[model samples]
Target: MGLLDLKAPSQAGTMTEATGQSSALDPGTPQWSVFGQLTSPVTHPWAIVGETILLPLIAVSLGLWLNPDDPLWVHASFPWAWFAPVVLALRYGPLTGIGGAAMLLLVWLALNLVHPAEFPKLFFLGGLILVMVIGEFSSLWLARARRAEAIQRYLDQRLEFLTHQYYLLRLSHDRLEQDLISRPMAMRDALGAMRNHIATEQMDSDSAGASALLRLLAQYCQLEVAALHYLVDERLQTTAIATLGNTSPLQADDPLIEHAMQTGHLCHIAQSLNQSEQSSRYLIAAPLNNLDGECFGLLLVEQMPFFSLQDETLQTINLLLGYYADSLSMHALAAQIRRKEPDCPPEFAFELQRLWHIRQSSQVSSVVVALEIQSRPGMPDVAQQIQRQKRALDENWLIQDVDRSILATLMPLSGQSAAEGYLSRLEMWAHQKSGQTLAELGIFGHILPLDTDPPLALLQRLNEIAHASAQTRPLRPHA
Candidate 1:
């Protein structure tokens, strides 16, 4: 038989459909039969040779024991010996079968010469030739079946791996769509709804604003806890102003909070909570920075089941929290500005002059001197002047507008000579401006004591001196 004889039959039409149904019912049936046949061949070279060699040897020994004096009985008993070559051919394949047959023929001829038997030598030779053809065909068919089975198994494994990879790709695509598109849009809509409540006229105070923000963040982000902490600076002693979460307010030592505060970046802790024991889960902290890029506070949020605190999510949270901080800070600053009820007070003016005189007389290690730019011809716009001054003194001093005519600034932790040098730079800047001369403008300044007074009080004193100086010196024309 050729290699085709070994292959499992491919069913046709209705039979194929039936086979598919049967395979579904019994998955391993085909594989079991294929492997079984490969291991146990019906008739092979080894099997035939082994049996032929053992059978004759046993018969001769039995005959010798039964009749020691019967010479004719021994010669006749070996009549079945001619069949040994045929048996070898049936059990083994063509090459091994032919070799076994040749060996048996030589033995039979030698025995016939020694004690001539009645069997024909041609009969044994003809039987061996027939067995060779049959054995060769059977062995060829078995080898072909093994090859087909191996090929089928290899193809099946490849198909399975491809199917698994396809499903995984689909799952990844769905996750990306949900995370990038859906989640962000949902967050925006939620923020808009919260903004409606915040814009209402009745809502006031930082605490109320913080509470509103926390509620919206929790709802949108699916967080279990959300808290806002305000920075409280009490003469360099910083503390938390308000907390809205169930957990204890975060101390200065908390790593997540400290990192957020220091870097003004978002920080997160994964697997920080125990669900069964009711511990805080994942924590995400975003820093709230001012327009000056100074961190004012932190917004701490915690999630259950540990929601992914990815960079994009953290950035969105930071942006929204920053807006809340800006709005609240603006409201507080406006209120504080309104409470200070003075354009220029006499006592403040006298105190400012006294401080300036003391700094000029004393030889202290460090004194902060500041110049008050009362009037300028080109920039009559106060807002524009403030902006320009801010840009100019971005890193130099702490500047603030006291009133319409005066701008007060502090050169913190500096001395009288340094203050004088700062004043000279201000004079040069004033002279450089178009339509303005240094001598033409009334610019009075003062150096105040860094201790024993608040920055706000010092600012108030400077304002008074600036206003008095402006009144004393008449307005100069553009030069």
Candidate 2:
């Protein structure tokens, strides 16, 4: 998560380098120099032991060389030999500083054997107290430093992710500007047309709309030579069902195709295959995958103008292919759901299925709120007010009857909390508009999660509840 692991920004000389905290500093790696190792908290235990044993010994030897009569430096203006233990405590911690002081004690014992001098208890005791105090300060700062480093690492990763997203956004904006000048229709329009085409045409098999998908890719991607192949028995077929231009035979073992299949994402020439492998003959290969990670087909672009083979262009192709795959899957799912519940609106069923797939793939949640309003003199007007206040992304299916009105609103990418918030808002708004709360008006709500139950079952339950509401009588005037 450090700056060292991040990809370099497009522009050079970032603030990380300006402050001299270069990205080359890897905290995990061992430092080479003894001082360097001591400065870092990641030093090895053996290294610490060696330094602890040697530092005091070196100081004693220097003291002996300077004044053999008082090698402990007790009589000197300053106790020079005690400085070693103090430094060790500042670098490591209290325990290490205590270890260094113990080594000095051992040295004093060994010297006493030779000279029979009195043990300097005051010298050793004072040194121990100072080392302990300094070690405590060191420990406090070390903890704060580690916490700061962790925070900095997290910030670095978030900044890197945002930088990459910004770069992609800029590229997409450029692509949009170019498309506005060159293309006659918007990308959303093209996707809508493709969706409509798939919905209207018969999709008896997996390869039902392969030709239309190829034509759409050709028109948008300017693919000079490309082919789309269907998947059979969990494998991509060797034969191309639809080709844009004069295309060669499909290579089932192509590296790009194999990578796309393995990763279930688009793989292009720019991506690094293994270092041992050579360049692939195709420019790009992408799997036509739905939101649930199901691959129905593969797209291979053999040739395109050099100028058009950009990150933005490849992203556009990937998006279009994914959209097509999802459309096919949605059409099939919607048909199955509609077959089970005839009264469910086509738009409501299709969106519910799509949201279910999204939940399975991305873990995003969606909620369905079913409101049953008993038929009364003023209830129809309340339903109209609620319908007008629907969120932009919400899809509603209103079923009106002589005895009751059922309004089912599908809130996409929302959970139970969002559903509760929405109901609360509706309650307040309805009270303000109708001068009475929803409960007083005989309006009840049931929250159904798209993920908790299958789409068909959720729709069926909503309908069953509506039917039950029809048999009930309206609320009388409140006492």
Candidate 3:
């Protein structure tokens, strides 16, 4: 509220040397004073009041003890009792020092006026005023220094916090790159490279994604040959197979493949777990499951390193293959729907039909939120997070440009305010919750009503927003 209260900070410093701001300044405490525990600045109100009142009382008590017959300063042996007030003024601020000195001056005046003047009143009063002035200067400087230190501590803590967030964000992006793409890179530049890959590789056709996934395995997993199997009519059948590095492509399903398909869990040819005399070549098969937990396909690998057969590696392969299968399933389903309808996509046709009815109703409204990601890669995790947080009535679309970075969500029966609120939440998740700052991301078209805005026009506006979001944006990261 005031300069005096500047001693306190809104929050404590982070876990660093410049930790955080102090709520209050206490001169007696460490780091509170300019010198090591030198000046104890007056903080507590009652402590200063006591010191001011107690000094004057002690002076009066000493005078009365010296002369019981007349308990007045004039009857005492000493004329000047100024040491107590001076010391109090030096330790406390101007208020306490001046108040105590004024009491002593009253005693001095009574003694000199009643009896005789032994000491010059002008000289005595001048000395008291000087001490008060000196004490005030000392206290003022001490307060300023403490306030500065507290502010500095707060800034340092903020810097530390931001540094940690950036480091972790960078690390996650790097790990994502290493896992998603088989290219090794410097830790610092991993995210940028991954972003580039995502911008190019994202929203690829099911065939393209599967092909890339197999290529990745060939490079990183050190597989000589890989095959894909699909579950058709309750039986596993080979769909596609890839070979690399002079390895022969296996057309027939081996016992290893059949066994892996029989059991849903990943199966691998290993010397430690099984001692059967088989070919020295290594083989592994992992099942790709859908949301319903039904096996959709099989991912086969041959001649992989035994060391890479651990649970972590198997899990990673399974997840990647599963994601690839999901893309395949979605694209295949979309094609089927389009062929049957021939007029419009099944979902789009249904939405338009529903919009026709909702248009007549005066109560219902619908809007769209178009988010354009400018910095981070549009990974599956980000989409999954949006899906988890989205409402049942909303339609989430993965619309890709040359630089696949934007996601558009349409509200079928929702107002403008609801759409904007959801946009704010998405911004918060990107910046605060997901550790990806909105500074690099941008929002366009606060809300667009679906009933009023044409579908093609809305898409064009969203595309315009995506282009504009990256051009003019903030780079600041918030906690």
What lDDT does each candidate get?
0.47, 0.72, 0.53
Tell me the TM-score of each prediction against the true structure: 0.33, 0.50, 0.36
> Quick one: best TM-score, which candidate?
2
Q: What ranges in model 1 sit over 4 Å off?
A: 1-206, 212-269, 273-308, 311-378, 382-404, 449-457, 466-479
lDDT of 2 at 84: 90
Per-model RMSD to reference: 35.8, 13.5, 23.8
Point out the worst 10-residue segment of candidate 1 by lDDT: 3-12
Q: Summing lDDT over every window of 10 consecutive residues in candidate 3, give the lowest-scoring window.
A: 3-12
lDDT of 2 by residue, 1-479 (tens): 22123222111233222211223353533347988654665477898898889889999999889989887798778888989988888889899899999998888888788668777788888989999999999988876676555445434533443443344355456657877777766555555666666766665554446677777677667788899888878977788877888999887887777777866666677653432266788878887776445788888999988777654465666566766776777677788776777666656778788678666654566899888787787444767778887886688999877787889999977889988888889888877877888777878888888886878788777877777643463322211
- How close to the true structure is residue 286 of candidate 3, measured as C-alpha lDDT? 68
